[model samples]
Target: MTLPAPLTGVVPPVCTPLTPEGEVDVPSLLGLVDHLVTGGVDALFVLGSSSEAAHLTDSQRRLVVRTVVAHVAGRLPVLAGAIDMTTPRVLDHVAYVVEAGADAVVVTAPFYTRTHPAEIARHYRLVAGRSPVPVIAYDIPVSVHTKLSAELVLELAADGTLAGLKDSSGDLAGFRAVVTGARARAGITGFSALTGSELVVDSALALGADGAVPGLANVDPEGYVRLDRLCRAGDWDAARAEQERLCALYGMTGVGDRARMGASSSGLGAFKAALYLRGVIACPATAQPQVPLSEGEVERVGKHLAAAGLL
Candidate 1:
């Protein structure tokens, strides 16, 4: 199916369910997809930060994209992350995901090596030139160590070098600048501005963002879906209430002890733990090198789910 111009609504970065041995749990993955689809997500994003893309091997990433694209079967647009260290490697991922049937590819600034704004621009231009599907710029300064400026984003949007932006930078002022620019700029139409923040979907949408790619939605897609609808329906009071509920639920991301693991472990572990507690996935095990949540942390996740009426 053709992706909607300015794609909107809840687009969860679907979690990559793993077995005890850390291999992709195909059945569990498919079941999770069914869960999200049934919960009314407008689209699916695979191999994203929430999916533990950094930990998966190249073949595993390909398998993830292929499986999701095949399972979704065009019911909704599927976006795949082509995250890598540099331009050439990212383009390689772009080829693989596009061949696997991703409707659009999400990319970030080149990482691990020092870069300039000019280099970032060049990188995006190169990728956009070769990619068959639409290319959405992913501004994740926390991970990539480079913030995509609103000016660069607007310039790219005006010239057709970018089709959308998925901002996880946690900088609403900057996000709003891109959103406003995308709307105000001439010769730029259907340029989607999606917030990747789980805590501020209402604010993002209220500021004219097209949609959200909240990672927490993997655990409770219906909640995010309801939030999106309430926002779109212009029920500010209800939307604020729903957003606050989800924010409280978002507390589950801190279940893991910081001394024992990194933020990725805590956040992603909490998400998978919530899924397992909710009976969405068979196992809550995260990928290797990342610390697994202890029973106590899992209990905390369960408590959060119960508080949110999810369990």
Candidate 2:
């Protein structure tokens, strides 16, 4: 299917469900897909940061893409995150997921190596040139240790090397620049500017972003969809109310004790815990080496769910 020009609306970066044994739980993964699809998400993004793609084995990552693609069955676009340290490693992942049926591939700037702007541009241009499906740049500076500048992103979009961008940099001003630039560029069509900011979906859309790829959407897909529709319908007040409500719900990500674990543990662990509490997934187990939330933290997640009416 042709990716929507400026792919818009809610696209949840799916959380990878794992069994107690640390293996990909296919049943739970499929169940999660059903939940998102039924919850009115516009698309599915598998193998993303939320999916623990960095921790997953190559085989497990391929399974995730293939399973999500097969289950989605063209119902919505399935974009897989082909995350790796550099271009060559990332290209291997790109080939695997694309062959497995991902509608598009999400790549990040090269990490580990001292990368130049020239190297970053060369990396994306090479990937996009070789990819069979559309290429969407995943600009998540926190993970990659490199930020995708508005100048570089707009240049790539104008050149047709990037079909879209998933901005997780949390720099709203920079995000706004890319959003405005995407619109202002004369011949750029279908270049989506998607925000990974869950707490500011309404703000991003209001600033003229094409859509949001909020990870919190997995916990509350309907909320973001409502926010998106509210923004589109020009119901700014209601959208702000809904967005603030979600921002409150997002507080659960911090409920996990910081000193006990890292942000990924606290945040993603909270999300998985919320999913398990909500009955959307059978297991809340994250990949190994990541700290698990304590029972008290799990209880806190339930309170957030109740407060949000998710329970």
Candidate 3:
């Protein structure tokens, strides 16, 4: 299916379910996809940070895209993350994901080396030039080490280099700039400005964001979907209430001991643990190098789930 011009609503960055040996668990993955679909997500994003894309090998990434694209079967748009350290490698990922039937590709700025704004512009242009599907800029400074300035994003949007943006920078002001610019700018129709923030979905939507890409939605897709509906319905009170509930559930991310693991391990491990406790995924094992949550951490996750009424 062709991606919606201004893709809107909840688009979960799916978690990659892994076996005990760290192989992709296809059955669990498909079951998670079914859970999301049944819960009414607008779209699915695979091979993203939440999916542990950096940990997955080339073949694993390809399998993820193919499996999701085929299972989705055009029911909802699938946006695959063509994430790499440079443009050429990103282009290779773009080719395979598009060939696998992804509706669009999400990419981050070049990492591992310092880059200029001009270089970032060139990177997007190069990828867009070669991609068959739409290209959405993923402004995740925390991962890429370079925050995409609002000016650069608008410039890219104006020239048709970017179809949309996934702002995970935790900078609402910057995100608002993109949303307002997309609306006010001429010749920039159908450009989506989606927030990757789970805690502020209502606020982002209020500021005219097109939608959200909350990772927590993987554990409770119905809640996020409901939150999206409430916001769109102009029910601020209900939306805020729902958003707060999800936020409380998000506390699960902190259950892992900080001294033993980095934020990725704690965050991703919490997500996977919640999925396991909720029966969405078979195992809560995270990728290598990132520590898995201890049994106590998993129990804490269960408490968060139970408090959120997910248990």
Clashes of each: 0, 0, 0
Score candidate 1 by TM-score against the native. Answer: 0.99
Q: Which residue pairs collide, candidate 1? A: none
Question: Between the candidate structures 2 and 3, which one is better when assessed by TM-score?
Answer: 3
Please tell me which predicted candidate would have the highest lDDT against the true structure.
3
lDDT of 1 by residue, 1-311 (tens): 77799899999999999999999999999999999999999999998999999999999999999999999999999999999999999999999999999999999999999999999999999999999999999999999899999999999999999999999999999999999999888999999999999999999999999999999999989999999999999999999999999999999998899998999999999999999988989999999999999999999999999999998
Q: TM-score for all predictions? A: 0.99, 0.99, 0.99
Give the residue spans of candidate 3 off by over 4 A. Answer: none
Order the candidate numbers by lDDT, best to worst.
3, 1, 2
Worst 10 residues of 2 by lDDT: 1-10
lDDT of 3: 0.96
The count of residue-pair clashes in candidate 1 stands at 0
| Candidate 3 residue-wise lDDT, 1-311, digit = tens | 99999999999999999999999999999999999999999999999999999999999999999999999999999999999999999999999999999999999999999999999999999999999999999999999999999989999999999999999999999999999999999889899999999999999999999999999999999999999999999999999999999999999999988898999999999999999988988999999999999998999999999999998
- By summed lDDT, which 10 consecutive residues of candidate 1 come out lowest? 1-10
* Model 1 lDDT, residue 106, Cα: 96
For candidate 1, what's the RMSD?
A: 0.6
